[model samples]
Target: MSAKSRKKNKYNFLMRMRPVLRWVLRLRSTPKAIAGGLGLGTFIAFTPTMGIQLILAVLGATFFNLNRPAAVIPVWITNPITVAPIYTFNYWLGRHIWEGPPLTEVSRQFLEIGRTMARLSFWDIKDQIIAVLSMGRDVLIPLVIGSLAIGLITGILVYLFSYRLLCIFLFRRGKKRLLNNN
Candidate 1:
């Protein structure tokens, strides 16, 4: 593409993003509201359920009258690229909290078990499923607890940082307006 065309495309992209950005900036939320939104977004982002983050964020933002875009944007942090790391961290955190084996050891064992299972017959697969289902509580309990803890921590941190940044941006704009008026 020509330089001019590239520039135009860039401008167009920015223009399209402007409405969403402005919506976030114009939110009349108190600091608490902003923080709540950020925290909620972070919590939703780390949910084990996939493919529903955006919907959850929209509902949360609307219910709370928060900046919808601001609340939704941070959820992208838990997308495909970061999923493994986030889950691994959660697993390790769970292990620590539960006084269980380290995540790395569990992961190694899991891999070994998976490899063995791959060579199993269809009947064996069915048996495995039944076994897992029978003891589902053992697996699920730790997962739920760890995910909630991590989500809460992540939410608090995001809220604090975003609130501070938003405050700075608003303050700078107010200062500029005063200077212009003077």
Candidate 2:
């Protein structure tokens, strides 16, 4: 993209994020609370838990004394558009980290699953179901492991960055406005 278009895109992205930023700023909570809540939400979003993420984030934020709204906002990161890619990358990373199953084995399991689904039900063959479940175990273990690793690192980075930004844009600006009004 051209420099001008890139700038416009950047501006548009910021505009899209404006509502969340406004919500953050409107809260009377401490900067740490807001940042921690945002960080907690971000961390929860990266996990394999799809439906319960929002609830988890809220519970975590409440337990940890973080801002609830800030905690819930980042959970939207794992919506339909993003869930597949994020989980796929995490699964890939997990496979590398723990070396779950051979690629050929995974590929074979998928093909077998497809064939079973197409012809008869997977429940039709108990042995086949067992094999698929075992294969699933191999896949699931690594994905969870990798997602936790990524989430921890990302959550920490987000906390630090959000804290710094809140300090700069919120507190510093408020102080200036107060002084100007005096």
Q: Find the candidate with the highest lDDT and give its number.
A: 2
Least accurate 10 contiguous residues by lDDT in model 1: 127-136
Residue lDDT tens for model 2, 73-171: 889887545655676677777888887876555545545544543455423455434533555677878878988988888899999999999998887
Clashing pairs in 1: none
Cα RMSD, each candidate: 9.7, 6.9
TM-scores for all candidates: the values are 0.62, 0.77
Scored by CA lDDT, what does every candidate get? 0.67, 0.78
Candidate 2 at residue 110, lDDT?
Answer: 48
